[model samples]
Target: NCIIAASDYYLDDDGKKAADLYQKACEFGHPDGCKWAGWLYMTGFGVDSDYVRAIKFYDVACKADDLEACVNIGFMFENGAGVDQSYSAARDIYHLACERGALQGCNNLGYFYQEGRGVEKDIRKAKSLYEKSCNDEAVWGCNNLGGLYYKGLGVERDIQKMLHYNKMACDRDLTIGCDALGAIYLHGRGVPIDYQRALEYFQKSCSNNSMLGCSFLATMYASGQGVTKNLKKGLKLLTRACEHGSNLGCNLLKVHLANEKAQ
Candidate 1:
């Protein structure tokens, strides 16, 4: 009912109606509803953008001690949305959510340690937290862990392990992971040159809407490395990739078309 009301209010731009339903839901102990109200206020969705009110609603939900709300508070503190920036406050909220087994909290903590945002730079701790998040099936964590391994950040330079983690993340449907793995395979890093595997991974990434993936898959098709030469199909994919925000795709597609015209 609250969802329906929110949806209806959204369609009609009825700020008062949305606020009323959100208030009722919050009063009923629905932390999610409270969080949504906070978001609505924060983004000015059907209401005037009010960071103060957003913070108030988030504070109310945080007081309920929900892990998600704790994470939101961490974000708020980290970004100083409605309050003064306080790394300590962000760290505490992140810790609270981590204690509650929120994988995202682990990932955020890893980011904090990596960037020394609120703490000293500790690559070891960052890797540990990322590993924990990956174990919890966090795709972002797994993908970033693969990057860490690739960069040898606080870990031994093990290219094979990098590919392994990239493959793991890609198999879990992470487009970035798939694109990274495709690059690794294409360059024969940590493994023998396997354009077929690279093509497959790039295709998977492209299917997931990765511009780089589409561009690279087009390259492979044009080169006839992993598949037969098909300029028309390759050009189509390149155009699509370019439309999807890849300047590399646009440049390559232009070069390809020019070469074809010359031929």
Candidate 2:
């Protein structure tokens, strides 16, 4: 299909060609073509960024029963992109998508209920939605559910339940879940402290791109908690964590660098 080819071209950085092909496909009434064209316009990838035009194309695709387009429209409304910001509108749209069986919609709607963003604050409803989303294989839902269990929000405090859900999420390659498990082992929260196990979990989390895990692992290295002390390796990990957007890592690196300069 021309749309698929256009996507390949876009991936190869031929934005102009992709945009042209997408336009052609749109003329043929391809729903995905319209959606991708709107995305390009929205992100200024292959065309000038124009929220109005983007919304127009997205509206076309949404009318064609493209659920992703509807999600995009909901995002645009939530963020006030070429439209008045309205959390209520976003919630209604997300609800529609959820009713249509979109897992992401269910997860997002659960967040709204949890935070009282658009709907009335309802921790019980949030818990139920999270359960549904998790059952539907949304990793974030598992992570959220684990947090709620840990905090005893909408459920009784259950460390075993928290650990089970977090482990489930980690087994699925979620970095946040790995980091959480690492913290639990490192701090002896519900189990005896095991520095070796903590290190292993931290390594997995860091390799999976969790800056917090990198920072934790770096601390272990610096303090010789589990492995031999290696300040150089610790600093390197801290640098990487900082580069990946960990403010704590950045501050620690800055202080270390300053101390080195003083030395």
Candidate 3:
């Protein structure tokens, strides 16, 4: 019943009905139903956002051995949403999830170690965890491993390694990876600047809701670095970024305007 209600026939206005049906399915012992109920409550697609309610449903699923539910619970604990902030609890939950074969949980735990949120900072541990996850094809793990190489944390700076990991993530369609790759080429980060390559990557990420990618794309267009200069197109791109909450885009729009007026 819930699946039918939530199929292509589900409309935005039917959030309440969908959530209720999912909750009913949970009552029937369906873990996925419980998970869906929790997610809908957590995100408030068409209902009031209620973290407490979300956690309650998620707990039901988690107790049923849902590793994904455990990871979601950890996120709430990590951020203190509807529950007292407890990094230790979050860490424990992530460990449980990771130990149980949840790759995303391993990535989360690695971040905790890297930032020392609930444990001592251990760059080696973070790197190891990221490596494990990345080797398993976790997109976040690949991107994060690339970050370690870029920042030289617990490892020597290696642009090639950074490029390698980021490319791995990007190949998996990770927007952040695409954005980072674009920046690398645009700024000549340990490599000769290649505006053309940068443009390709920025195009991928920008089209996928990355404001930073859009901002960088605007730079390429405005400066005529790798493509023909077109002030109108540049301004339109900048406007798109600015409307999407990019301070850099807003600032760049001003500069673009001033430059155009001076010409």
Q: Who wins the TM-score comparison?
A: 3
Cα lDDT tens digits, model 3, 103-146, are 88999999999999899999999998888788544689999999
**Model 2 C-alpha lDDT per residue in residues 1-263, reported as the tens digit of each score:** 89989989999988778878887888899989989888888888967788988888888888888887888888898899978999999999889987887666787788889999889989999888888877535777888889899889989988889988888888888889889888988999977898998999899999988999999999898779889999899999999999988998999888877876898
Regions more than 4 Å wrong, model 1 = 1-28, 34-62, 72-90
Which order, best to worst by lDDT?
3, 2, 1
Off-target runs (Cα >4 Å) in candidate 2 are: 10-27, 36-57, 135-137, 259-263
The clash count for each model shown is 0, 0, 0
| After superposition, candidate 3 runs with Cα above 4 Å error | 7-17, 135-137
Q: What TM-score would every model get versus the actual structure? A: 0.76, 0.82, 0.92
| Superior candidate under TM-score, 1 versus 3 | 3
- lDDT tens readout by residue for model 1, 1-263: 88578768967978767877886788788876787788788788777887778878878887876566667778889988888999888987887788788777888888889889889999999998888888534777787788888888889888878887878889988899999999888988777989989999999999989999999999988888789998888999999989888999999999999999999
Each model's lDDT: 0.84, 0.87, 0.90
Clashes of 2: 0
Q: Candidate 3 local accuracy as lDDT?
A: 0.90
